[model samples]
Target: MHPDGSIQAESNSSKADRALFNSSEARRARLLPSAEKKKRRMPRKGKGRREMAGSRHPLIEAVDPLAEIFYRPRTVTVMTVGLCLLAWFSDAFGLYGTKFSAENGVKRGLWALIGTFLAYSALYAPHTFMIRPHPIVWRIVHGVTILYMLFLVLVLFLDADQARHAFKYLYPDLGVALDERAYGNDCRVFTPENTSSRFANIMDTVLDEFVLAHLLGWVAKALIFRDWKILLFLSIGFELMELTFAHMLPNFNECWWDSWILDVLLCNNIGMLIGLFAIQRREKYGNEWVGVSSQPTILLKAKRLFLQFTPETVERYEWKMMSSPKRFIQCMTLAAACLACEVNAFFMKFVLWIPPRNMLNTYRLFVFFLMVIPAVNEYYYFVTKTGKEQVNKLGVFTWIFLSCTFLEFLIIFKFGRELFREPWPPLVKWSWMAAGASTTVALLIWTVSRRNKLKTQ
Candidate 1:
C-alpha cells in the first residue's frame, strides 16, 4: 500500500493478478480476501517515494486495468495508417485546396476537429492527473486543457475586433458588440412600507437562470475544499471580492441582500451542504471493489457501474485556516486561486464580447469543474506530504489550471484595455491597496510569531 491508503496491484504475474489488472486508478479489487488477514507489502516500500517504480511520467510504467489485450508498447498504428490513406486519396483527387460553402465547410471542419481531438485523447493525451472512474476520461480532459491553451494562444495573436469577428466562423450569432452588466445597478433593499412588491422583485432576481450556475459552482468549491471552515472562508471571501471589483465590473454590482442573503445564505449554503453530504457518504464506503463479472444480480451490476462514476477512494482533508504558517498560506492561496477563477469567468465574457449564454463560457466552466477534481486532489497530496515523500513538483492538473489562468489573464489584459477605458473609483483604488498591504503585514506578523514560539519550544 502507498502511504495515502491507495493500493497498487501487480501486473498479470500471479494467478490472482491474471484475473485482475486494476492498478490504473489507485484502486484494487479484493481479489484475495481469503488469503490472509495481514496482507503482504510491496518490496519497494522501504525504498521511499523518491524511487517510485516508474519513468519520469508517473503512470508510464503502469498498465491500464480496463483493457484486456494490448501491444508490448503503446503505438498509434491505426491512426497513422488511416491518416496516410486519407492524405493519399485527397492528394490524388486534388481536393487539398478545394473550397466549399461556408456552412458545409465549417460543419465538416468541426467534425474533423472533434475526430482529431478524440484520436489525440486516445493515443497521445497525457493521463498523469486524474484516474477515477477511468483513465480515459481524464485523458480526454487533459486533451481539452491542451486544446484550450492553444486556443488562448491563437486568440492572443488577433486584435480584439479581429478575435471577436473570428467567432463568426464557429458562433455566427456573436457578431454583435458585447452588452455587459448582467444585473442592473439597483442596489435597493426591501422597503418595509412596500413589502409585498419588493419581495416579488427580490424573488425575481434570485430565481434567474444564473442562480443554478452559482449553486453548481459552489457545490464544486465545497467538494474541493471539503472542510466547512475553508468553504465558509471562500464563500464569504468571494462576495467581498465582488464588492471590491463592483465598481470596475458592473455585473459585480449586486444588492446587499443579493450578495449576502441570496448568494451566501441560499446558494452557497445549500451547495456546500449537498457537497459535504456526498463527502460524508463516500467516507462510509469500505473500499471494496468487486469485479463486474462476479456480480450475482443485474441490479447490483447496474449499481456498481453507476458507482464507477464516483471516486475509487475517499480522501479526507484538514484545511483548518490556523493550522500552521505554511498551512495558512496554502489555504489562503487556494482560496485566492478559487476566487481568481471565479472573477476571471465573468471578466472573460465581458472582455471577449461573448454573451453570458454562449456555449464557450459554459464549456470553459465545465472543463474547469472537471479539472479541479484532480487539481484539488493533487494539491491535497502536496499539502499533506511529509519530507519523506520528496514531492517537489506540482501535479499535472494544477499546472494545467495555473497555465490556463495565466493565459486567461493575458487575454483579458490584451482585449479589455480597448473596452473598459474608464478610471477606477478613488475609494475602490485605495481600499484595494490598503487591503493588500494589510494582508501582507498580517501574514508576516503571524509567521514571525509562529517562528519565535517554535524556537522557544
Candidate 2:
C-alpha cells in the first residue's frame, strides 16, 4: 500500500511539469520582435509614422501635374494665343474693315506687330535661359509699366485728339471718331434731382461690370495661393482699401451702409468666401473631373456632358502659408495695385471722353485682362520661388500703362485749361501729390520691415 501511494505522487508531479512547459512555450510565441526589425519589414509605414511624429500634421500627397494645367496660368496662355490667332485671321479677312489708307495700314500693322513681338520677347524669353536673376529686374519693369501708364493718362489730358488718332492708326477698325459733333452729347451730366438714378446706375455698374472683374480677381488669387485663408484676407482688405481712397475719388465715396454692410461685408466678402469654399471642397473631395457616363441618371449625365464642353481645368497651387508680416505686405501691395488700376480706368475714361461701352474702353479692358495673367504669374514666381526673378514685364501691360498715362496728360492739358488757368492753390495740389507719394513709400517700408522681421524670427 505505501509503494502504490509514492508512485501516484510522482505521476501527478510529472503531469504538472508538462503543463508548466506548455504555458512557457505559449508566452514565448506571443513575444514581438524589436522595433528596428518591424521598421525594416514595413519601411514606408515607419517613415510615415516618423513624419507624423515630427511634424504638426501629415504631408499631403502630390497632385497630378496634368490636373494642374487646367487652372489659371495655362488657361490664360491658351486664351492669349487664341486671341492673337483670331486677330491675325480677322486682319487677313478684313472682317473688321480697316479705316486707314493702304500706306498707313501697312505702316501701322508693321509697327504694332513689332511692338507686340518686342513686348512678348522681353516678358517671356528670359525664362528659357538656364540662369535666373533676382526679381529686382521684374520690379523695375513693373515700375516702368506704371510710369508708362501714367504717361498715357497725361497724354489724354494734353491731347485727346492725338491719342484718339494714335489708336485709329494702330487699330483703325476700332478707332475713336474725334468729331464731338459725331458723338453728339453722349456724356450725361448728373443733377440733384437725378441723384437716385445716378446711384442706381452706379449700383448696376458695380454689379454688372465690377462684380465680374472681382470674381476674376478671386480666381487669380486662388490660382496663386491655393489656400482659402489668403484669398479671404485679400478680398476683405481690398474693400477696406476702396474705403480709404473714397475721399479722393467721388465714385468711391458711398453710403456707409452700402460701402461697409453691402459692398464689403456682403458682395465682396461673400464672393471671396464662396471662392474659398469651392477650393476647399475641391481639395477635400478630390476633383474627379471625369466624364459623366457614371452618373446615376441620364438627365444628370446629359448636364455633365454639357459642362464637359466648358471644362475648366483645375491647377492645384502648392502653397506654404506665409508668415503674418509677409502676408500683410503682400495684401497691401495687392490693394495698391487694385487702386492704381481703378484710378487708371477712371482717369482714362474721364480724360479721353470715351463712353463706357465704346470700342476704346472695351479694348483697354480686354488688353488689361490679357496682361494680368503673365504679370501675376511672374510676380508670384518671384515672390515664392527661390532664385527665379528675371521675369520680363508683359508687353501689353507696359504699352497700356504708357498709352493711358499719355492720354491722361492730354486730357488734363486740354480740358483743365480753364481750371488751371489761374494757377489757383498750387500748395493744395502739391500737398495732395505729396500725400499720395508718402503713403506709397510708407506702405512699402512697412511691408519690407515686416518681411525682414519674419525672416529673422
* Tens digit per residue, CA lDDT, model 1, 269-345: 99999999988898897444554444669997678667667776666687666877788888888778878887899
Error of 2 at 393 (Å): 12
TM-score for each of the candidates:
0.80, 0.44
Candidate 1: which pairs clash?
Answer: none
Best by lDDT: 1
Q: What TM-score would you give candidate 2 relative to the actual structure?
A: 0.44
- Clash count of each predicted structure: 0, 43
For TM-score, the strongest prediction is 1
Give one digit per residue, the lDDT tens place, for model 2 in 210-246.
Answer: 5676566565555444555556655555555555544
